[model samples]
Target: MQKEAIYHRPKNNFAYAYDERTLHLRLKTKKDDTLSVTLIYGDPYDWKDNVWQYHKQKMLLTGSDDLFDYWTTSVEPPYRRMRYGFYLEDESESLVYTEKGFFTEQPLDTNDYFSFPFLNEIDVFKAPDWVKDTVWYQIFPERFANGDSSIDPKGVLPWGEYPPARDNFFGGDFQGVIDHLDHLTELGINGIYFTPIFKAKSNHKYDTIDYLEIDPQFGDKETFKQLIKACHERGIKVMLDAVFNHSGYYFEPFQDLLKNGEDSKYKDWFHVRSFPIETKPLPSYDTFAFEASMPKLNTENPEVKEYLLQVGKYWVEEFDIDGWRLDVANEIDHQFWRDFRRTVKQIKPELYILGEIWHDSMPWLQGDQFDAVMNYPMTSALLDHFAHETISVETMADRLTSLLHSYPDNVNEVAFNLLGSHDTPRMLTLANDRKDLVKLMYMLQFSFPGTPCIYYGDEIGMKGGADPGCRECMIWDKTEQDTELFDFLEELISLRKSHSAFGNSGSFHFVSAKDGVIQYKKETTTETLLFLINSSEVIQSVEDLSLSNETTSLFGNKIKPNTALTLEPFGYEIISL
Candidate 1:
């Protein structure tokens, strides 16, 4: 046994309350090193004489990545508190692992075992239930449509007439979104995540000049209210972007600081390095990435915190917005977010709070700060394998397995998963314009755990490069849209919503990743779904799927129980058993 590779802890993902009564525990060992693992646990005080009374339950090998195998099991302690340890075995020997260290035999002292003090129902990570079932559509308001051209910004270009630039605008507004509600409904999107619609100088609206008012270009507060009402009437939830990390150059406080340096009462609102603020060369203050125009706010300041908290509360209390997608959330202080979560959730207990974090966000997702973050790690891995062809299928499977084990099951269930977004290249562009590859990527995204999101024009096959290019105007002309690709995605969204085993309710596990083919299964209480995708250019065949007699094909080719299942180049199959 590789003792160095064995590991466990009493908090976070390794051990957590899955619900009010159940505590989920996990143990990790070197890949293929341990043949079996069993959980030895009991209430800490449940002891008689000198021996500690306990029960042992076997842990299932839930997943294996490149370096580790994860074993998981659930326990319900009668007293709601317990101490636990793992008994691990390989062919050669067996060992008892506990908090103190490795032991030749199980320890009778409760102190030697890892302790879960109590399963507090309040500490359980609970996101809004609606988020798990939602299929999000991310709309960059400035590029979506221009329903009321009368409110068009000065020098606004004709829609889709030219390639997008950072400073250019096409006068996309709330009315534009309200006018085209049918597009999203037909696409089967139940949640709309709009990029910043607050008053700002740039088209992207990340640099906020005013948090309480809607940008005039997007219409006033009344128009936004109407948009929210129309969306709710259609059963679509709305999530607005909040840019509290920084303020635009024209933001009043920032403007005052630029003018009155030391005399400004708002000097503490920002992080100014020197008495005289300068924007040339580099600003004398902290800014978002070194951009002088976007000054980072000192969220630790009491006034700043109060103002932002009010901003969070005002939206939910007045407009009835369903959620808030926080931008650059990781850059802010943890306490601010904790207060933010409490303030907004108090008004609307089910309001979804999503953070725009691009990496591992376990610190902020402990049922305190954020319900979920933009799942960029998963996005990068998927893009690298399917779109860029930089990683092999086996490597892709390993990366994905590691990602799933990084968080609790509930966190993964509501994670904001996306392919292309306003920040990256379009999926088609990343896949070198191969529609089949894009479809394959979508297939995996929708079938995997968590809610799936689509960028504005990705379903219709709009192609662009990064940043400004990715923010192209939505293609409204039906003749120019890729209806075939649209239909494929529409079917996927429907499958995700209609089938229990095909969505977040199911348990996911990898079956195989060999011969350039990646296969996995999503199992529920009553049904199991098998998904097979050929990532290679050549056709692949699997001879022994070991399907049951009652198995049937939900997609792709149908085959007899013992027949070799052959898939075409870049092909896929969805089997139901």
Candidate 2:
């Protein structure tokens, strides 16, 4: 028994309220060290005569990584209050673990057990229920499609003629998005996350000059209303970007400050360091990443707070936007976001608020702020295992397990999982243009829990490096696109939407991983899906799979029940039982 490897805590992911009535508990032990674990729990006050009343339920081995195995179970107390502890057994020893410490035998006193005094409904983390069912499609508007050449920005380059650069713009507009509604509908995405459509100076639109107006390069107010209406009619929810973290250098207020030193009426709107602001060798005032073109806002100011709060409310109340993907969310103050959530949800209670946090985001995800954040950690793990091949299957599994266990289950369900976006290299490019490796990457992404996003052009096998390269013009011509890859992705999306087990409605666990072959299972109440992937150059076979004869193949043709299966290099099979 590896006593030192056993771990559990009373808060956070280790112990959390799954809902108003149910509490989730987790325990970790050295990998494969524990044969079984039983959760012995009951209300601490439910004592009869001289004995403390309790019940014991066996815990399931939910997931494992290189160094640890995680066991979990859900329990409901009649009073929504309970004290609990674990009874673990290994091959050679058995022990009882409690909040205080390990015990050679089960303790008679309920005082020594871990406690959940009360399960308050208000404390449970509840994101929008609709978010888990969404399949997001990220669109960089300027390069998607030019529906209105009449509204083209001056000096716009011909679509798809030149490689994308920092300053170049193609005439992509709201009408363009409306024109391509069939593409998104056929591809089966329920959510459209536009990068930034608000009036801004740069092609990317992160440097916002006006928070309320739709960029003319895109369309007018009425045009945007029509676009949203069209999307809603097609069952697609619309999410716009909010760049409140900074303002463009040419913003009216910022320009006034630049022209009139400290005496300007808008002096307190930003973090101005000196009387005369300079954008030379170093910005005279604090900026976003030291870029003089983007000045950080003074979120703490009373007037600034009202202005931004109104901006946050205007879209949801007037334009009927379904969500807001906050830009640089972590850099802003927590109070601002909490208020932002209140303001937006007031207009639409189910509105999704996703943040652009690239690191641990528990602080902003306590159910009072953003509902979810862009899942960058999962992207890095997939890239390392599938694209870069820098880690073994076991190591990758371990990393993934750790990430999953780092958050409450509710948060995990709605996390914005993506392989590529405007901020990173395309998955195909990251895999050195290896189609097989890219398929494997998407397989894991769709199978894992969370809302998955498809970067524009990636569905058609687009390839490019980071930034300007990844932000290439979308390919619309049938002859120029990789239809085969598109077909493969379309099938995967269909499977995900059709099966409850393929998305957040199920629980995930690795069934087997050896050599270059990996197998995992996603199980729900009514269905089970088993995926076998071969990531190596050689063929692989599974001879001991215990699937029953009733199992049906959901993906590949050769897979059958209770039989050996063979996978060619980079091949995959999804079977339903």
Candidate 3:
């Protein structure tokens, strides 16, 4: 036994409430170190005749990453409280692991164990229930389509006539999105995450000019309401981008600050280092990424807080949008987000809140702030393994396992998972234009947990490098789009919707990942799904698939049960049991 490798904590990913009644506990040990683990747990107060009442349950080996194996189990305490410790066994020895230290014998008293004090229902992390079933499609409105050229922005170029630039617009609007409702429906995605459709100076719309008004290039308020109505009619939810972290240079408040300096009534609205603001190497005031045009708002200010909070409430209250994808959420204060959550959820209890945070975001996901972050860590793992081939299949599996165990199941379920957003290079481009690699990437994405998001043109095999390039206009001509890839993506989305095991609530575990091939399984209470993918050029054989009697081929070529199967180069399979 690798005693030094044993790890656990009283809370967080190691232990947490799956809900009010159930507690999920996990322990980590060095890879292949512990032969078995038994969880000895009971309410700390459940004592009779000077002996603590307790129960012991065997923990299952849930997953392994490159460095560790994760053991997990779910238990229900009659009293909604728990004190626990672990018994580890290996060929060489047996030992007790407790809160204080490792021991040769189990501790007699419960005080030596870790305590979960109590499971508070109010503290449970509850994301929107609908998010678990949603497949999101991200649209950069300015580059998606040109439905009404009459509302085109000044100097707008012909659609798809040239490569995208930082400040260029091709007249994409809500009307265009309304026109393409059928496309989204046929593609089988149930949610639309539109980036910054509010009034802004730039084409991407992240630099907000008005939080309450829709950008003229996208359409007016009424047209947006119509678009939302159209989407809801088609069984699709709408999520708008909220750029509350900063304001554009031309925003009325910011402009006034630039003009009035110290005398501006809105002087407290933003952070200012000096009387005369400068915007050269660095601004005299704080900005988003040192960009002078984008000034960070002082969300702590009372007036600014009220204004932004109302902005958070306006869209859902007026247009009935289903969610808000907060821009640069990590840069803002926690209290403001908590108030924002209260304001929005009061309007619609189930409305989703996604944050554009690129790193660890546990602080914002405790049910009091944003429901989920953008999940860029998982995206990086996928890209590193599938697109760049910089990491081995085993390494990828380990990375994913670590990520999945980093948060509670509820958080993982609603996490906004995406691979080529407007911020990154296209999946196809990253895969070096290899459709096979792209298919493999999407296969893993759809099969893995979380709500998957497709960049606007990716399903049709649109390819480009990073930003400006990746933000190309959506291809509308059927003859020009890659129908084969689109159809395949549609099939994948359909599979996700129809199968319980593919849903975010299901369990995901790696079956195998070695010699240029990977296999994983997703298990729900009602079904089990196995995905076998070979990313190498040579045929790969996986033996002893361990199919049950109810196993059947869900997709890919049919194979015999409990027998070895050969996968062609870049081939994959989805088996249901």
Candidate 4:
């Protein structure tokens, strides 16, 4: 055995309390190096005479990536606390692995094994249970609809008249959202993630001037309350964006600091490098990516922490909002988020807290801070393989497998998975306007683990590039929209909701990935679902896929038992057995 390649650590992704009674454990070994792994575990105090009593259970080889094979199993420690170790073996030899070190045989003393001291109910990472069942729709309020054009900003353009720009507005508001709530409901979206509805100068609303007040352009707080009521009545949850990382130039504190130079009471609220703030050569103070209009907030300040915490609490306590999506969450200090989570969750214990982080976010997801982060890594992988064709199917599968193993299973369930958001190019545009490819991408996203999300207008094939380009006005005219793509996505959402194996309730595994074809499975205790996608231009076939007499196709054509499955270019199949 390759002892150096074997790895495990307690109290993180590798080992965690899956629930109050169950503990999930994982072990990693060099790719194909270990033929089998057995978990030896026992309650630390369950000993008699001079030896420790324990039970051994075999761990399943869940999946393997380029460099490692991941083994996983669950144990229900009777006493809710245990010491554990792994016995790994290859053809040549076997070894016992534990906290102390590798040994020729299983350690006699429990102290030599890894310890999960106890499984406290509070420490179990419990995100809102509702999140796993939700399919989110991300709406940029400024572009969704203009129900009441009377609230239009000064230079608001005619809706859909011109391509979106940083400075242009099209009079989208909460009333517009209220007007279009039916569209979301009809599309089966149960959660709406609105990007920054608070008062701000920019059309995107990331640069917040007022954290507590709704932007007049999006209507007043009363109208927003009505909108919330409308959404809740229709069984939809609302999640608003909170940009606590920075404030706009016109933000009262920032403006005051700019005016008073050195003697502003809010001086500690921001990171001002020098006395005279200058935005000419470079920002004299810290800002969001050198943009002079946005000054990064010093969240470490006690005053700033209290203010932001109240902002978090006010929405849930007052409006009964269901969730908060933290903007640029990775930039803030960890303690502030811990306090933020405690504050909002105390008001509504189940209120979802999502973070806008584009990379690995395990630190913030440890039951205390964020329930989930924007799954941009999965987004990038999907875009790379299905849309851009920059990576092969095998490479994409490897990347996804690694990502799934990066966090605890519970965290992955509520992960905010998205393909294109306000931050990236539309899925159709990224797929070079091939709606079939976009359909393939959607199939994988909806079938994969995590709560999937759809960017506004993506279901109808709205095409745009990044940033300002991605923020186009939603198409309201039925004649101009791609109704077929809409129907396809609607079906996907329906399947995700109606079928347990098709959603987060099932366990996911990559079955095959080769020659531009990818195959995977979502299996529950009673049912198994097989998904196949052909990313290549030419037709592809998979031989010898066994099917039962009772098998049925959820998508693609029905097939016979033990038949070879064939898919057209950019086609897919979802088989239920």
lDDT per residue for candidate 4 within 1-577, as digits (tens), equals: 7788889999789999988999999999999899999999998998788778899999999888899999999999999999999998989898999999899888898889999999999899999999999999999999999999888999889989999988998999888889888899999999999999988999998999999999999999999999999999999999999999999989999999989989998999999998798987899999888999989999999999999999999999999999999998999999999999999999999999999999989999999999999999999899998888898988889999999999999999999999999988888888889988888889989988899999999999899998889999999999999999989999999998888999999999999899989999999999888888998999998876777674668864668887788889988888886
lDDT of 1 by residue, 1-577 (tens): 9899998999989999988999989888999999999999999888788778999999999889899999999889998999999998989899899999999888878999999999988999999999989999999999999989988989999999989999999999999999999999999999999999999999999999999989989988999999999999999999999999999999999999888889998999999999788898998999999999899999999999999999999999999999999999999999999999999999999999999999889999999999999999889889999888898888888899989889999999999999989999999999999999998899899988898999999999999999999999999999999999999999999888878989999998889888789999999989888898998899898778786664557754556787788889999989886
Per-candidate clashes, comma-separated: 0, 0, 1, 0
- Which 10 consecutive residues of model 3 have the lowest summed lDDT? 548-557
Off by over 4 Å in 3: 548-552
RMSD of 1: 1.0
Q: Arrange candidates, best lDDT first.
A: 1, 4, 2, 3
Give candidate 3's total backbone clashes.
1
In terms of lDDT, the best-performing candidate is 1
Question: What C-alpha lDDT, on a 0 to 100 scale, does residue 521 get in candidate 1?
Answer: 93
lDDT of each prediction vs. the true structure? 0.92, 0.90, 0.89, 0.92
| Residue clash pairs of candidate 3 | 65-398
lDDT of 2 by residue, 1-577 (tens): 7889999987878888999999999999998899999999998888899899999999988888878889999989999998989999987889999988899999999889999889999889888898899999999999999999999999999999999999999888889899999999988889999998888989999988889888999989999999999999999999999988998998899999999978899989999887678998998888999999999999998899999999999999999998999999999999999888998898899999999999998888888899999999999988998888898777777788878888889999999999999999898999998999999989999888899999999999888888999999999999989888888888888998889999899898888777988889899999988888998899888776666665557864655666689889998888886
- Return the clash pairs for model 4, or none: none
Better of 1 and 2 by lDDT: 1
Compute each candidate's TM-score over C-alphas. Answer: 0.99, 0.96, 0.98, 0.99
Worst 10 residues of 4 by lDDT: 549-558
Model 3, residue 445: C-alpha shift (Å):
0.6
* Candidate 1 clashing pairs, residues 3+ apart or interchain: none
Q: Is candidate 2 or candidate 4 better by TM-score?
A: 4
